[model samples]
Target: MSFSRIKRACAVALFCLTLSATQINAQQKRTKGCLTECQPRIGIVSAFGGEAEVLLAETINKQEYVINGNLYTTGILRGNHVVIVLTGISIENATMVTQLTIDHFNIHHLLLSGIAGGVNPDYKVGDVLIPRRWAQPLEVYWSANSNVPAPCGTPRDLSCLGLKLSRFTSQPNSDYQIPTPNGPVGTGLFMRDTFVRNNSNFPNGEFKFDYAADPEMYAVAQTIAPKLDRCGPKNPSLCVAVQPRIRRGGRGISGPAFLANPDYRRYVFKTIRAVSVDMETTAFAHVAYANEIPFIAFRSLSDLAGGDDFTDVSALFASGLAESNSSRVTLGFLEAWSQKYPE
Candidate 1:
């Protein structure tokens, strides 16, 4: 064969190989995006009793669960790909289980479902607050001149660390909106891993529910998000932080066996933004968002946050059950989201 003919044939082979490689790379990129932004196996982290628990039994499918030493399972509502966990109100415990559920079950899309106390007076027990905005620790300091360790463990992969730092720094306001059925919901930074009760500062020896007396959700998110986001090079972590938009009210608050305590009211309102406070949702949201997993949370109002009245305790307790009724309406929002992206 002539040299010219052989050279022409070699060029044709190289062109074909290039085209095939381009096609494969494109397909891989598409698959990764789908995996990142798809419907997640929904999980609810909540206290063991009250309207949140009752609704779980009523609406979700039943299955026994043993999560991080806790044993309880109310349901497994699939198709929507939901898994509910009753974590009993500790920030550390809730964060661990959330990570466990996400890692073991491959639940990318999560919902931190349950109720919370309301700081906003306009909200009453039965009113719901869906977070559409979010705020992370924006002013964290990394000792200015000293050699700092990687933000995550395993030392800094300068390439990845540089990318992450760039992304966070570029967005001065790292806060994002919570996706919702009606529209976008407001989101905010919640203090977590802290007690919820009245401090001695508020008008009635209670916390004003701000930075001073942080809520558990904020701490939970901080702990859970970085861990999850560090899992892989491709992980996109995002959490949907939510607070129940009313004063303290729920079955646990109202039962005949219940006793009203002023300290509980004053301290709880002083710590968290919303009035009434619950155990689970905020932590779950932090984990979800921090890991770049899409999430949403909204709870029905259960009580009025301020004022003085022990006899009025009965009214406060009764109001918590309102979550049961409102759950029916909000469940649709989650349902529609699942239909669009069945995970």
Candidate 2:
């Protein structure tokens, strides 16, 4: 071939290579954008003490850490996944850490893990309670007399409120349900946070809680869901859904948190119906769900709420077992999630 002809051929090949490079660069830019904007970032929230510490320590990359008063340790677990721990058990404190994690880390998925108490009679010591809805406490006040109304607001019949009632019920405990096209739905699996110990330990050695409503973690989910999913991928955008169960490995014992209840007997059952009676999971669930970050809780039943009148504190420390159960469930859930979201 002539030298001029050869030069022309070389020019054509160069042009094709340039075009290919440009296309590849464009695709890389798009992928990075998705990671920053589209892909769901996950997080975990749990209290410092009790079963939460154990479960968190084992699953998370052990690098002992603390936030505020809450102690936590985090690191890579499964491939690209990362886990975070909250410092303490208070709803306000846990919520604070959760918010910080989402904002600072750009995390989109959040999970609440820990142990909780059983309220339903059907739930055994080892049985779990996946909170379906968080119940909100009615504004109440003492009546000067029986006929007169109480101080806060009159207790209006809330059952007719429909979805609102469900929302309220979930708000207190921090366990939330999303209102989807197909009615309200909870997270697929029951993540245990509360536990029971013995067969005979509640009312008349048979466990029971009074029916009175209050607040817990679902309140956080209700408060934050709108804030998180405002702009993201997943078409309809993701919302928070929580289901907290129990780990029964714990000895039947109640903590000071439960003991602090003014009318423990009357309100315990009522509070369970309205909110997450167990402490830790709701905090994690609420923060992740409300912020539009994806999260799922996996807790274990560690304590029976009724044994020894729920007075023993040491028995409630089934931290090791709780962590073990959470690890198994979380890994399984994540594996399934990867199949659905094969990014």
Q: Pick the candidate with the highest lDDT.
A: 1
Steric clashes per prediction = 56, 59
Determine which window of 10 residues in candidate 1 has minimal summed lDDT.
Answer: 225-234
* Predicted candidate 1 versus true structure: per-residue lDDT over 1-343, tens digit per residue: 8999999999898999999999998886444323222333555555435645554655555666565575545344524555566555655555677766665454545555454444444554444444433222221223222233244553322233332321222232222233458964423321212122222233333211122112322222222211111111222131112222222221111111111333434432332232434445545555554445666554554444444522323333443334343454335545555455555
Query: Candidate 1 at 325: error in angstroms?
Result: 3.8
- How much is 180 displaced in model 1, in angstroms? 42
lDDT of 2 at 171: 28
Best by TM-score: 2
**What's the residue-level lDDT of 105 in candidate 2?**
50
Worst 10 residues of 2 by lDDT: 206-215
Error of 2 at 247 (Å): 9.7
RMSD in order of candidates: 17.5, 18.7
Candidate 1, residue 306: the lDDT equals: 40
